[model samples]
Target chain A: MTSYVSDMRRRRLLAGGAAVAGLAACGLWATAARAQASLAMPQPDSAEADRIAAEFTGGAEPLAEGLALDLPALGDNPAAVPVRVHVTEPMTEASWCEEIILIADLNPKPLACRFRFTAATGSADVAVRLRLIQSMPIRAYARMNDGRLLAVRQEITVAAGGCGL
Target chain B: MARPPRIWISNETPAPGEVVRVRAQVVHVMESGFRVDAEGQPIPEDLLTGFTAMLDDALLMEWLPETAISQNPYIEFTFAARHSGRLRMVWSDGSGVADEAEREIRVG
Candidate 1:
């Protein structure tokens, strides 16, 4: 049978689509047409992580401080690597982390997951496992309730690639 | 049916103004949908879509899990110790199947 989605197109769509899929629900576009729209998004290049984060910050650059992302200097496993994102700023009614986005630049699907927080969460400190595809920089952006955004990036070296697939 | 999950808080009983760490984990395939079977056909996506931590009626945190999350996903976070209540960790899949684990948090 002839292929409807070419292999290269399928690969590119899978890369960009899954990333957008994670954001789709939050973006409020889960309809059937949204799937096609996300798949039609531009192909991810080397700067994929930055572009994804921009969607959340609304072009406002995140500060380098008040946030820290913890991952190993070297991740031996591409399948389940540990990660921790902590908002250094105090969490109070006046200020707290509103949302968090984790991006693995080298992965086929760059946007891994997003976390939404409230004052009840205390410090906005979270830890989870992620699949890393290659030895590259992992970026995290945190949206604060005080109209400020914080971000941190760490160079995580994984042994092999393709774990995200 | 699946087995229950594990939830651990560093200090369940803490004085007011104290913060405690929480760790929770569950079992799931977390299928990425990128893998193909013997016929080289893509596998349909099936994975937990959301995880939540709640204390009584208050929502502490929520995580949206994607295919990049590992099998048998695990997560950890921290919360302030306030009034005593039941702390619950809930995990839900795309089909709206919600599974949860709970613990009594006695804040002094």
Candidate 2:
């Protein structure tokens, strides 16, 4: 009878130890996952977004609907995404365009590319290839000759595996 | 008194009225000489820093590169062709080494 009682106690202690070890393993896994997520800049912060906005707008608040930026529907290759920006307004001498800038909202550095146009260029069709860290909002801002700032944004879903990761 | 370099040009046959794509790659070690050798002595720097390509007496491209370039430098450019002639490639290094090579092309 005494041996039976001792065996029951030993079994209970073993179960308790196993439970503690499993909990510890789970905790360790969670901590490691959090560390990895922190190391990745999968999203842009408010300050970075503001800096990108100010680069072309010169601190003036940009009107968010005048320019149109087109991005890929699905980007399986995160290394390069084909982007094109088209301005509907007529480009003329008096209607000259100043500059166009591309911003990747989720990239570690949001400022991607910039192009300054002259009055001689009558069309605002700019084609370029860019690297996307992940799926994020892409923005295009146009500075007009009249000194007005126009901006547009589009969201794209980027698949896993990209450059600079 | 080194071996004569060999230069090859792609796009031997170009269109009648098209920009001729020219790609030239040469074999040479562009040593900066700043790094120390395994024996703890400063190695002398030797590298090609300047290169010029001409087509029938017309300068097509000229470049000034730093020592950070790879051992073999590859250059690409465009030349508007009028007729067939010899393309000359000339290069010089900081170590006082100079070399030249040539290739012929037919411009349709």
Candidate 3:
């Protein structure tokens, strides 16, 4: 009878240990998931370029081609980097480029500038000077009148003091 | 004090059914508010936030600039060329400071 009682107590203790270990494993998994979620958020010195594009495109994923992003691969000065964008397609009253959104992935604010055009804005080609904070990929999203989001990306290296200001 | 804006057109007088490029520049520091002074004080933002180009009576294009634009911003765009009466450009800042210029566009 005493052996039977001792065996019961040992079994209970073993079960309790097993429960504790399972709880520990659950805790580990929860912590790991939280860490991964945090990592998935925007990284430092980076912008969620895709997310911004989607917002502008009314939640439609942008087509990754069709825009001509003209800029220097290496920028000797971040203060004034020349950038030009040309939409190769024809512009018409029925269909035209409505706007162009310029995004600097590493800038404090990703949406750098927006150029709005109409059918009378012939060619849909525009150029401007940009101020980049660092070396990073930049994107130009063109929103067409027909509800298409056209995108192009370019990577640039700043050669001097960062243009943070 | 803000300086006057300067504007140039690739061709003021173009043949019918032609496209002309328009270049506009406004002189300003385009000071971004994110900077810190030598004493680690935040600088105030001063920028030309809006630019509009009009060909005669129609709006050709508009540019919305932010802190990421360089000082003395140079913007270039294109418009359908004709014997437009005028090409007008207006540059404005956030706090109501504005400057504008107009050029007569005549076809031969």
Model 2: DockQ vs. true structure: 0.04
Q: What order do you get sorting by DockQ, best first?
A: 1, 3, 2
List ranges where model 3 is wrong by over 4 Å: A1-47, A162-164, B1-3
lDDT of 3 by residue, A16-71 (tens): 77667786654544544321111111126543766777788878777888789998
lDDT of 1 by residue, A20-39 (tens): 67765455444544211111
DockQ, model 1, C-alpha based: 0.33
Each predicted complex: what DockQ? 0.33, 0.04, 0.26
The TM-score leader among the candidates is 1
Residue A142 displacement (Å), model 2: 0.8
Model 1 segments beyond 4 Å from truth?
A1-44, A161-164
List iRMS for all predictions: 7.0, 12.7, 9.0
Name the candidate, 2 or 3, with the larger lDDT value: 3
Of candidate 2 chain A, the 10-residue stretch with the lowest lDDT total is A31-40
Winner by DockQ: 1
> How does candidate 1 fare on TM-score?
0.81
Candidate 3 all-Cα RMSD: 18.8
lDDT of 2 by residue, B1-108 (tens): 555664444477766434465555666665445445445565566666676667677655555544323455554444445567787878778766477888886887
Scanning candidate 2 chain B in windows of ten residues, the lowest lDDT window is B61-70
| TM-score for all models, in order of appearance | 0.81, 0.46, 0.79
Q: State the local distance difference test value for candidate 1.
A: 0.80
